[model samples]
Target: MNVETITKTLNSLDQLQRNTAIQSDLFSIEQTSDLTVAAALVKTLENLGVRYAFGLFGGGITPFIASLEQSSIEVLQFRHEAGAAFAAIESYFASGHPVVVFSTTGPGITNALTGLFAARWEGAKVIFVSPCTSATQRGRWAFQETSQYTMSNTGIFTSGTLFHYATTVECNSELSEIARRLALGVGKLGGFVAHISIPRTIQTSLLTTPLPHVNFSPTLVTAGEDTISKCLQLLCEAPFAIWVGFGAKDAALEIRQLAERTGAAVMSSARGKGIFPEDHPQFVGVTGFGGQNSVLKYMQEQRPLRVLVLGTKLGEFTSFWNPVMVPSRGFVHVDIDPEVPGAAYPYAETFSVQSDIGAFVRAILKYFPEISRSSSVLPLPRPEREVIKSHLEGLVRPEFLMDAIQRVIVENSDAIIMTEAGNSFAWGTNILRFAAPGRYRVSTGFGSMGHAGTGILGAALARNRKAVAILGDGAMLMNNEITTAVKHKIPAVWIVLNDARYNMCDQGMNMEGFHNVDAEIPSPDFVMIARGMGADGIRVSRECDLEAALEKALALTIPFVVDVIIDPTRPAPIGSRINSLIFHGK
Candidate 1:
């Protein structure tokens, strides 16, 4: 058949298949006499599997909050709107379910900008709901007014920079379309943030018609036969490695199978840690700032002929965009987003295939049996595990802290480990060995401080697992949601590495041969702060007291904080990137 006829036939078949599936999945609308817009909104969200809504309550959003109180969805109140938004994002990360975040008006929505930005950057699925000035009193300077029609430079939320879909619902008729958009946004692959602003007047409006249920069944994108053939041809040539990213989290089993079948050495981006078992013989270390040197050495010395880039953008933090990390031969890139293939490294020869990571891996697995006997590729040599048990001296060192945490994790294998940006992330990513996916959570793309401090609460609640948030003293002081955790009775352990300064910044300046005094900052006793917040607290300054304190913290039913005074003089483990940061500018 001709290309045009073939394409037409395939399109018709796809539409027919979708129609058949939709017929089965469609929900019958049950008409209710007294369904307000607020109730309809909450019911739609509940139908979409949203169980929790995090935010502060205010007069502007009183109706919506009241409706939520009547619904099955649980409302989690936070001191700050940003904390609530961050918590929702983290919850989505843990559960793979989009959560709702609310804000009042004007400043409430603006305060949530940072968290929303981080959510967008990390590709987290979050629905942001906020109240706007009443449609009747929009331009006449209403109380806490936040209407795009009246405010100046207020387009940030709706500017498409932070949200996949942003809309202000002024009428009851818009709710159905809004519900459909939200369902579609959440159903799509990768993270998406949707913002819906409901005017105060519309919240109490009675919905005349029954709310329509959206039929959401995302079709899996798989590699075509031609793409598979090309990939197979590339794999037939040995000495190729696989690079995995956070997008490949669901394809862990298939990834492992592919690596073993081809005898390919596997490395991962920082966010991709624990996707493939790091302890496996075929596993090379992570690629990034806090990455393993042995992996870099392997890439430098035993240069791979080609690389199969799986679901990673290979951005500045991942590859540093340096030639040293980029394979000399070329790369075959696979990603869910069609635009992400050659975005980072356009200079290199990139064979791009847009497909879901799991489906793509499974597709590649089918061809593995055919070429299994013919492929004679060998895995890279295993890197030596650096023993740092004896490195514990007078003051608590970063390495010693990592070792202790590793020991604690080994004992409590089910606990989810999280880290804030800076030294905490570097130490955790480098030292902590996660055997499975969903155990290690870190926000490296946005790299926002105080993210884990608040985000851990949502993660703990979502996973129903003990969450250990290892963060810097600065981050802990910035926005610790310990109060929220305590209020909700979440089992969260906060390990504060208190160096009495922004150690990452201080060390970076020192490495660059520049002396900056602004890096040093006074830190309050976190133990006392935790106790003040109605949570248990412990102070551990010595190395010997570390593991015991961790054990005690882990056993606590409520939120607990372990404040460890780390040595400020000791440098953070920021491998080769120091020179790159210093000399690249010169």
Candidate 2:
């Protein structure tokens, strides 16, 4: 089995045969002799539908990086390991496909932990590939040694909370088992994060055994007929409200239909924006952190009998476990993971159902009559929109900037919008309105500062269209991949709120009666940084220039940046955050 012969054979196959060979039971053919462990692993990942690989190339992980370059998977060399991991997570969300994040050992491995943890928390399918020290160099302090002697092998190299499945490839014999485990893990419902670490020597070792043949079929959990009937009965018994989360994104259509049929007031978690059209008549405002005051008003006034929770864990960021959100009849919560339903609101009576959000919703839709009529005529609360006129001289207001973005970006284009953690998240969640799913992405679960600033490149690349990232200056300065984006000519637009401070912390401190918090930073000219990195950029100091700057950034074919100098004095809508902090005695 020579390399040239294998290439010729693959090239000679018909399109149908090639598709079948690559997608179904890829390892059944005799193809191990010509491939090394790294090459075999790359092929396996490609067969598993991994289209992109992002990471920094180091000596330890050179073999895998080289293999990735040779394969059909698009490879990107990021500026930082954490940025690469964040990009990998966004790539999955954008393409609805699993992505690979590669790294070297020791420091590279450690730097990528934050993004990997976020990938798990965000419920994404991401495979982490890295290299470790060889068995012979256990005690000796090799440069950046990653072995039992230097690093803790418990969570990094072994299966635990960090990864759904993890292992170190010690020999060629373990390749089949590893491939099998990965196939199963990725095929299952919900997020799957797996890590494979190979020693530098073992990476290039010729495979002795063939990779396992896996006929992988995705496992979709769906509710039974009885369960659907029970849920329907609960809904019809009394007035109910619909609460949408990020996990129910795929089921947006069904959720919308359900809401319309029941005439139920709908509210979404911060990350769950756009699942149901925010402008719909039955729509309420977003709930939880950076949420609207309208939601609280609706809860106090309308008081639905039971709330139907979809796909969210009702965590602190979404629910704050606020007693006001709890209804009289309790919750009929649905999620793929059974543990999630009761864990968020343990005291509340919850009827838990373990099922895929879309499948369950589709099943419920099937039971409905063909000519479905509205169930109620109660007037619902709608999210408030304020019209603010710009001032003559001072720095730009965030509200004015958001208004421009909403009109220019959200209303005009189909580009995905992402927001970084901090005041940026609060502003975007509170102001920007979306009417469709797959257009908004946020990481409330992990809430990493630089996640969006660095991840927008991957999102834009994967979506094959423009993607906008709204981030604070702290995040822009902390971590960004503008250089990598310029090199690849990715159509990513970064809108940085250049207020020269960690405004969220600053504002929160003021509200909490803290003085002189020192959360300020001397901000840099982000436009100059973009220009230096070979990307185009614009700076907006007045509210009048925001729409034009946004339009200019969106029109650019290459990577672009829009830096907005905002007024830090105007407090963001973070009163709920301060209340939550005070409630917890922080």
Candidate 3:
């Protein structure tokens, strides 16, 4: 049979097996009688491959916590709700699976907003379980009541702003629907966040019927014959480049092959780092903050005829919506999300395709010519290593610290690196190199400050590998989850750049010709604080001491912190940000 026929037969058999397995699992669950609403919910989560639940306990969620205790899911309790939520987000990033975050009503739910916003913006799959006051306690102002119809009108949960699917389960019969929705949400492309608020009364309600079967497999969209023909025709012509984003992460191998076969240069968004090996000859450089000037220069000079944009919106941060980067012949945009194609470059000549990035790339490969070897174009010359190193000197230059961290990362290639918002993220993204996908995580979408510090624990747990968080002093003070990491004995290393200032804002203000006195702040000795929190701590002030400190931190069995005093006078390289802010006033 031909390739298309074989593919269709295999897909059909796969669906048949999945359906049979679901039926068998449901039959087995039907024999169990100890199932309540809470137990059913936990079972659904377990079947969906949820292995971790990160959150704090409260009276409203007592029943759900008890259910989790009896299941295989490991419950990680955090001191704050936001930390738990951030941990859940990172867990999703590491595992590519949805993680559960539980919180009680009122204050607990409110506190988790920031983390949930971060998750939503970064496109991580998370299931948030919040127990609200019982249905009978409606307008009585019960303690920590957060019902939609209550006096406070806590409608934000279902406002459609933060979550892909949000609902209140007032009846026990809604568990099956909730399970199905959760599965669908988790299976969707680009990830999704789901919120299921169960009333206290419903938690204890008995389920009389057998749990419904939920088998959800995401649809893989492929380019149509006509679209494929058009793409092949366009790609066969010379003078084209490829722009990759986080959404194209799953298709890395195909992307690399396509780049090599077509002799096209490749550039990536910050979130898309490591999707294509940054050191490869075809890779131009990363775009956006902490990005390289070489890629911009290459684009300006080469001015390729066509640009193939894979699974990216080309948002303001990635493209700065600059006319110079848009290319002369416009772009051919391919993405799973139907609306993302023309969202950013509406005025440019665009060919939009709504398809799964991987499937589309594989389809393109089917039509691609088979050559003995790759014929990638000549790579642009990079800046001299000595010149780059000279600018990175000093005891606390951000570049110096990044270089030291990169060395340690090279030694422990399996270790995951997380960077917080601000100069740490800027310098790390620009300087550090990731050789594999999912080894680098950052919060560029929401740009939340404390994310890396708090999220590292979950990432380490999810991957069962050492996690290093590069964070700024301002963010470290704002919301470090060092205590949580210590409490769980998670292997996390915090490399704090102690600049004693909100450096990104400070530098941005200076670049914009404004002097803001509030940017400066006192730097606390993080070693003392980390030691006080029952974790290993080290302070490094001299340039000679950085490598040793990093090695020591990475060798620790428990959580560790390294505090390096950075020079505040050395401005962070944020030229792109300054220009964008000046022109766009974002």
Give the deviation of candidate 1 from the true structure as CA RMSD.
4.2
Candidate 1 residue-wise lDDT at 88: 88
Candidate 2 residue spans exceeding 4 A from truth: 1-27, 369-376
- Candidate 1 backbone clash number: 1
Report the C-alpha displacement of residue 91, candidate 1, in angstroms: 0.8
Clashing pairs in 3: none
For model 3, residues 11-72, the per-residue Cα lDDT tens digits are 44322111111122233357335678898889999988899999999999999999999999
Ranking by lDDT: 2, 1, 3
Ranked by lDDT, the better of candidates 2 and 3 is 2
By TM-score, highest first, what's the ranking?
Answer: 2, 1, 3
lDDT of 2 by residue, 1-586 (tens): 2334433443454421110111334356565787899998998898789999999889999988888999999999999989999999999998888999998989999999999999999998999999999999877999999999999978998888999999988898888888888888877778999999999899999999876667685647776655665777777677689999998999999999988776788999998999999888878999988788888888999999999999899998898888899998899999988789989778998999888888888777654443344466557778899987767789999888888899999999989999999988889999999999889889999999889988898899998999999999999998999999999989999999999999999999889999898998997999999999999899999887778889888888989999999999888988887888899775
- Candidate 1 on 382-426: residue-level lDDT in tens? 655677764345779988888888888644758888899989988
- Looking at model 1, report the run of 10 residues with the lowest lDDT sum: 15-24
What lDDT, from 0 to 1, does candidate 3 have?
0.81
C-alpha RMSD of each candidate structure in angstroms: 4.2, 9.5, 4.4
> Any runs in candidate 1 off by more than 4 Å, and if so which?
1-28, 149-159, 370-381, 390-393, 583-586
